[model samples]
Target: MKEQIRCAVLGLGRLGYWHAENLATRVKGATLVYVADPFEKQAEKVARELNIGKSTKNPNEVFEDPTIDAVIIATPTSTHAEMIQLAAKHKKHIFVEKPLTHDLQEAVQVIQTIKENNIFCQVGFMRRFDSAYMEAHNRIQAGDIGTPLYFKGVSRDPGSPPAEFIKNSGGIFLDMSIHDYDISRYLLGSEVTSISAHGNILFHSFMEPYHDVDQAIAYLTFDSGAAADIEASRNAFYGYDIRGEVIGSEGSIQIGSLRHHDIQILTKSGSTHDIVPAFPERFKNAYLNEIEHYIDCLRNNEKPSVDEMDGKIALEIALSAKKSFETGRKVLLSNPTLSLD
Candidate 1:
């Protein structure tokens, strides 16, 4: 096992910057050696702020560097497949954000390439590492929840992203609901067999040109006969709210809270509490834990908990949901790994 895993970060955007910060400061056994972004200034700024030795506008520099053992890919969804394949080709382990690729064919190809390379690839499904969700998962596995039956998830973003981002976000299901789909599968211990979805433009006119909706809902059926309903929105005026509930034959487990802290103030007028403002605030620990897990896997020469197959299946589920919404019907996934042909 390597004494320390040298790491590089690609795409220093919102999530990318956060990941770079974690690697530089919080995650042990990880050394943030390189940072890259198309915007020269952004990359240089991040590099300077994080005290990284190297920063570049081109991603090739990171992959070409033999000293770097791994990379955290926080690039856009459309670019995920190419970046992952490139990293794999360089024999660098990868930690990429969710929905492996926007296209199923590309996702299939990416999976094959990763397998051929035989490098560790971890998908960013941070919810699985969250303390609350992990507790629920452990209890459910221990039979505390008996036989899982139903899953309900709610994910509401306070506001929509810019038009440029929405145009390439792969719509709401892939962009937002993919996490819920993955977590539903994780907690219910089942593969998504079919999905029915619905969505509307709602408040964001900018999304219409992109055919993306500001809000959506998906109903999913699992191979274990478990069911799930997930709701996603980009117009949560109050705050960034995320919650999940798993109901079982014996009992139920609820996860998440709107408040950032446990304490709430009570008054004669009403009760008030600080609401989670965004994803970073809501899943801070989860983000840190996921990166640490990736580093640990590298040092121990072990495969990541969330691998290429999980990423592929989650993308498939999201694509199915999008199809259902477009066709106004339920889409069945007869073969989880159905061929592109």
Candidate 2:
């Protein structure tokens, strides 16, 4: 019989709970032993519901436990670097949610900590695990699409988050479009050379105080001569719509659909179908796939497909985009003066 990787999940918010549920029940070769969050009741409730062995209000306990082999840090973006550094100090393998840190210096420090500890660290860019996106990537790699030339991506949330979240979310690029940035690099197989970005507080006035926006867009020029346009919005009253397309010299590959099912009702007045209402529902399988992959990598002593370096690069691109938006100029990734803080 194969050994199981004992695990713990920190944070019990929406995404955190989902990851904990997957680690508890779905992921093979994984045993969820502990759960932690600042809210004692929330942590205890999640532990009880998931049948985890222990629950704690302090995350330090999770890092201190020698029995745990890995931890999924689903805590707030602001706390990622500290949690990651602590976990690395404990020599525990880590799976952290996206955008390692809003600040590039902190990202660099987190990368250094991971390297110094020689621990396996995987970032949660789950789009790479999605079936359609994976197919597109495979086709691009197989040369079925020849040399990619252009990319277009759309990401929309059904509604805006509270003002508090926006204030610390590092704005739209880091909180939302960072996914698009990561997937663009993954599918285009190139580094972003420069980016021009623009944003506005179209509907969410609450975002204005934070200098954040409800709608944003960016144009990316890649080293491979491929260009990309990404649009992100929190006012997708229609639904949680996400779609992407890549045009290559030979042909083009398209990914995603607005509809949840193939069938749509036809009527004299109109036609309608179910739409993806939220990210968790849309990327459920990808979330599970990422955790399973993390466990598999741990058991096999293999490196994760998406590592801290990828996280760092993605954060750099996101910061570049934000800087471009703020200054109303195209920002080069090579520019050394860039800083989010």
Candidate 3:
């Protein structure tokens, strides 16, 4: 028989609420025990909607709850490290949404604390769980793609965030393109060795306060002597266009397209198809799969497939890209090799 894991959802914002609802209604072998957020009303609303027994405005209370076995942290970027450290100290397992910590040193410290406390920590890198990306990963590991040599990735949002939000988002590389960094590594099975990047404030000038650009392109060199080219944009009015392809010695694998539906209309004008306008819609299944994987790992006493170390390494790449953009020279990475064990 599987043990039921008692869980708490931290941060009642968009992604936080999504996790809470899933834990309450979708996930099995897990019970939603509590919901916490800085906003008491939002927490109460989400808790009520999920029919959870408890709701609080304070996240620390969730960590202090002996009945809670694990916590899903959907908190703001600024609070991630503190929450992670606290959860580890309280001997609770954790599943935190990505860019583990805005500060690299903080990220390293959080991982060390989890290790010292023997707590299981899962970092959310949802793309790794996406079926298309999973198929690509499996094929590369199986040698079907044969000696993967190069990669190309594109991640564009339908619109930009408010200026106030961007100001605290740690810049475009850390805030957004970090996913591309992870996707590149997940596909190539190698670490980034160096990076060079260029940016343009092609659309939103409000990002100036944070030194964030609306559009940027970066080229990454990997440990296996492979390279990846990635471009990210805060505004892609055509929809949330995200796609990637890996070119290997033998063949290649491509994933994603502008998708809302499969059908396309054709006529004298041309072919027309709907485009997915948001990340949530496009990667909904992936997010669910990742959260479920975390709960299953707790039940089975197994380590997460993608853990804190994966998050740290991806952040390192994003940091390097940022420095490269600032200096106009390739920034060599000094990241310690990430261990999957």
Candidate 4:
């Protein structure tokens, strides 16, 4: 029998909690060894529920444990680099959530350390594991769309995040549109050569102190003569509608439909309507499927669907978009092989 992979998850917040729970209940050949969070109460609660082997406020305990083979970092954006460095020092495989780090320089450092350690590192670009998105990607690559020319992606939520979260969100483009950046690259199969963007705090004026923009639209031109338009908003009244369309020379492919066949029509003086809730319902399977893929990769000793380079490239595009937004001009992405400094 194969040995079980011992895993520790850092952070017990919303997303982290989900990671712990899913690993505990769904992942085969994986054991939940430890959980860490600054909030002791939250950590204790999850520890008891999942029957985790250990719980603590300091993540170092998990890092120091020789038995723990891997660490899943779901911590805040700022702490990712430090945690990744520590994990590498311990010779533990790492799976970190997106954006890598808040600053580009720090992101570069993190990648370098991982390379030096020669440990596997995966980034949480979960959407790539989703079935719907995978279908779209395969179709585009198969030339079903015949030399993709343009792509459009929309990611909108029903409401803005809390004021505190907005303060640390690194604006709408970095925090939210980063996903679209990855998806754009996936569908277009080209590096983003240049980007231009327009953003404003139109919906969430109260978040002005944080310089948070609630709405942003970015245009990306790829090296293959393909282009992509990404629109992101935090105040879509209908629901959390995320959809994409790939337009090529032959035809177009649209993924995700708001209307399901289960919708019932009621005839009351010729009136009918459909029910639409928030994002928690729309993308639930995508979230679960992502965790499953991570666990499978760990068990098989195979690389994850998304790796550190994908995360860095996504962050680079996002940072470029922010620069374009601020300067009112297009910003070009430097070659990945070239040193930015």
Candidate 5:
């Protein structure tokens, strides 16, 4: 039998729990050997639930463990760069959830460490592996959507996160719109040249204190002369709505909708279908595929599709949008890699 790479998942939060569970049972050629969280009880709880052999509240335990070959970092945004650099120093491959680092310089530092250590790293832009988005990307690449000119994306949550989370989330652009930034780049196959952002606090007045917004729209100009219109919202009360489309000279393609399932109920009230409650359920398959790809790369000694550079670019676009929102102007990327901070 082939050996499986011993893996540890840092942070036993909701996303980390899911990451560990996926690596534990779903992703072949990978083994979940340890799990960690700052809260000892929380770490113990999920470690027991996952049937993982080792669990610790101290992140250092996972980083120092010689048996572990890699780590999945699903920690809070602030801790990402630290965890990643530590894992790289340990000679472990890494798979990090997105928005790489809240600071661009830190992302550059992390990427440097990964390179110096000769380790593999994959960022969690799971949409790239989603069947629907993949189809659009493939078709666009194949010229099915000839000469792509415009891109549109929508992501609205059925509910809002805690006020505390928002305080530390680096605002809507990095927290929410970052996903769209990456998706736009993926579908358009281009980098954003300039960005202008408009934001308002339609609801969620709590954001006022932090200068964040409940809704935002960003306009992006790409190097390919293509433009993208992105829409983001914190409340979709109906459900977790996520969709994207690409418009080109020949035709266009669109994805997602309010409908959650095929079966629509018909009655005097009118036809209605369920709505996907949240992101986890909506992108479940993509999550699985991404983790599987990580394991495959580990086993084959191949580079994962989305690496640190991808994470850095996506982050730069997001930071630029944030800068735009703050300044009410179009921020130019004088250097694609230039840090807005």
Candidate 6:
């Protein structure tokens, strides 16, 4: 029998922890070999619980360890490009979370490095791995949604991140709306040609200085003549919600909501509680399915369904939207550039 691939996880935050725990306990043909975090206690705790081979505060330990075959980066968005470059230099396959990099130049460099190294690199656009979304994609490709015309994607969170996080989040367009950007591109099957956006800082007063718009809407014109509308909100008040619809020449398909029952009517003192909470719940299966696909891709030596180009294009759309929101004018995506802080 072949030996297990050695894997390590960087960053021990919420999403990082989840990736570490899941890869350690659930994935087959992979051994959880190391856990790295700047916080020593968090790394040690997770490593102890999972019986991982090593835990360290310095990420260099994991990067330098030749025995470690792959690394999962759940670090902050600002650190993605550097980590990717480092891991590529070490010839380690990498799994990085979304919005590949805060800057397009860095993104381009990382892609070039990964290609030069001839190492597998997968960005976390987990939604593409979703069964429902994949089903929709297959149908669209199979001509079920003949010649797509328009796509709409909505993503709303229950609340905003802490003020400190908001400052560094690259505003809502890069942090949250990027998901919708990716989905829109996936459904449209074409490159975005131009983008226009409008946004407001309605919910959080603290976000004003950072220009962190909490509510945003963007329009994307695709190269194939299809268009898409993406809506995003950091505060939903009630629940997390994400849904999409693809309208084509022949017909349309909509992804169902989270609720088991589509229709519910209640009459009690003229009050009703009908809508289900947002996407974290609605796309639970998608999260698991995405990770499983990553594992399978690694095991089979297959390229990821969502590659660096997909991540770059999504980031391009998101940055364009931000530019449009700021300038109150349409932004062309032909020559995409971003300012990294």
The lowest-lDDT stretch of 10 consecutive residues in candidate 6 is: 332-341
Give the residue spans of candidate 5 off by over 4 A. Answer: 335-341
Candidate 2 per-residue lDDT over residues 1-341, each given as its tens digit: 34899999998898899999999989989999999999999999999898989999999998888998899999899999999999999999999998788788998888888989999999999999999999999999999989999999999999998887787789999999999999998999988999999999889887776889899999999887899999999999989999999999999999999997778998999988999889988999999999999999999999999988888889999999999999999998763223323
Report the C-alpha displacement of residue 221, candidate 3, in angstroms: 0.5
lDDT of 5 by residue, 1-341 (tens): 33688899998887898888898788889889999998999889888888889899898998888988889999999899999989999999999998899998998899899999999999999999989999999999999879999999898987679898888888899988988999898898888999999989888888899888989999999999999988889978888999998998899999776676768899998987898889988889999999999988888888999888889998998999999999989999755744534
- My TM-score estimates for the predictions, one after another, are 0.98, 0.97, 0.97, 0.94, 0.97, 0.92
**Better structure of 5 and 6 per TM-score:** 5
Name the runs in model 2 displaced over 4 angstroms: 335-341
lDDT of 1: 0.93
Worst 10 residues of 4 by lDDT: 271-280
lDDT of 3 by residue, 1-341 (tens): 45899999898877887888788999989999999988899988888888999999988888889989999998888889999999999999999998899988899899899999998999889999999999999999999978999999999998898887787788889888898899898899888889999998988987777788999999999888999999999889889999999999999999897868988999999989999989889998998899899999999999999889888888888888999999999998854466422
Better of 1 and 4 by lDDT: 1
Of the candidates numbered 4 and 6, which has the greater lDDT value?
4
Which window of 10 residues has the lowest lDDT sum in candidate 1? Answer: 332-341
Q: How much is 174 displaced in model 5, in angstroms?
A: 0.3
- Candidate 1 residue spans exceeding 4 A from truth: 337-341
| Alpha-carbon local distance difference test for all models | 0.93, 0.92, 0.89, 0.84, 0.89, 0.83
User: Highest lDDT, which number?
Assistant: 1
Candidate 1 local lDDT, 138-202, one digit each (tens): 99999998999999999999999999988889998999999999999999988888999999988
- Our model 5 lands, by Cα RMSD against the true structure, at 1.7
- Angstrom error of the Cα, residue 86, model 1: value is 1.1
